[model samples]
Target: MNMSTKPENKFSEYLGNDEQGNMRLRLGTKFAAIYVEKGKDIYKETSKGLVKVTLEELVSKPWIRENFERERAFQRSKALAVGLQSSHIPLRERRAYKKRMGWVGAH
Candidate 1:
């Protein structure tokens, strides 16, 4: 990419937990409302329905956070490896990609 030239893509993304493991938070996209799981509750009932904790928290108790981290790291690398040009992906595609990438969307 060019150092001075701005990317045709409107925004970039990443995966990470907040200080309290909230959400990555975005703007003007489906993920704009995305959120990360937080708390020890394996499941919770929301207005939509019951939500289950991710595998990371589920296995973290018995084993180590390292296992989950490795899996997540691998997933991140896989997504990046696709080498999909963010700008070429188009807006609708980006929205759909994000929606598929996370489960935080309101049903």
Candidate 2:
């Protein structure tokens, strides 16, 4: 009858990157898509095709919540790295400069 069982491992499907090189998630039956709104709130595309679900609803699934936080941290790290690279100053000096400018600890 071809009845498919759920994946035991949460990360069984490696969805990989989309065309724009943004990493996508393997939402499975829990979700269809993840959307980040203003103020960093999260929304998930529900199975019934709902788009603007609450952050609480989104976080109900452990893997989805984990992935969301991981994605956010990765982006922040990338921004910091970019900022560090853009400046001609040395790494040590840049750290001090960014700290003084209130950009380092703020993010």
Candidate 3:
């Protein structure tokens, strides 16, 4: 897409600085707000309360750090793949497509 047609990216929007200079990121609606302590430890605020995230897990590309932001983007035709999949897809249609594609059945 052209620069003029490109939508804004909110991935960094969630990254904010607290008065104490802590890093904060608000994940999806299902997930809780994530906070970084001294840029070393990561914490997630959940219904069960604050939970610590291991550095190993956080450093993993497919988890909270990279994957979280990549998977949450909604822009120019990208939303069709990321944001609207659940709402746009009907179970019956999905099953039919899967059956036609010879996938056997839903997992």
Candidate 4:
């Protein structure tokens, strides 16, 4: 008997494009991977299956919580950098602000 087999693609379904237009795929049955133009692709797993989810829903998984925390910290740091770069802020005051924010020597 000749058995015909089909190749299985792990990223089986093209769910849709994210807001940035990067393609999102369903990885197997339980997870989704979003391809980004820059940096690493983001992977999210959900028990809700193929249903579309918001950013909060995607990052709410316990296994990926650390990634969410890291993202939050990065956003905070970016905001601090922008605030410290204001022309009106003196270098001395910026240094004081950094120290008060516990960011001394963190750069």
Q: What is the per-residue lDDT of model 2 for residues 1-107, given as tens digits with 9 covering 90 to 100?
A: 56456564344243554565544455554544544333344444456653554657755856665765676678779889999788788988877978999988856
Count clashing pairs, candidate 3.
0
lDDT of candidate model 4 versus the reference: 0.51
lDDT order of candidates, top first = 2, 3, 4, 1
lDDT of the structure predicted as candidate 1: 0.47
Residue pairs with backbone overlap in model 1:
none
My TM-score estimates for the predictions, one after another, are 0.24, 0.44, 0.36, 0.34
Q: What is the C-alpha lDDT of each candidate?
A: 0.47, 0.58, 0.57, 0.51
Mark the regions of model 2 whose C-alpha exceeds 4 Å error after superposition: 1-41, 46-49, 52-60, 95-107
Any runs in candidate 1 off by more than 4 Å, and if so which? 1-62, 84-107
Clashing pairs in 2: none
Flag the better candidate by lDDT, 1 or 3: 3
Q: Supply candidate 3's per-residue lDDT for 54.
A: 73
Clashing pairs for predicted structure model 3, backbone only: none
Candidate 4 Cα outliers beyond 4 Å, as residue runs: 1-32, 35-63, 94-107
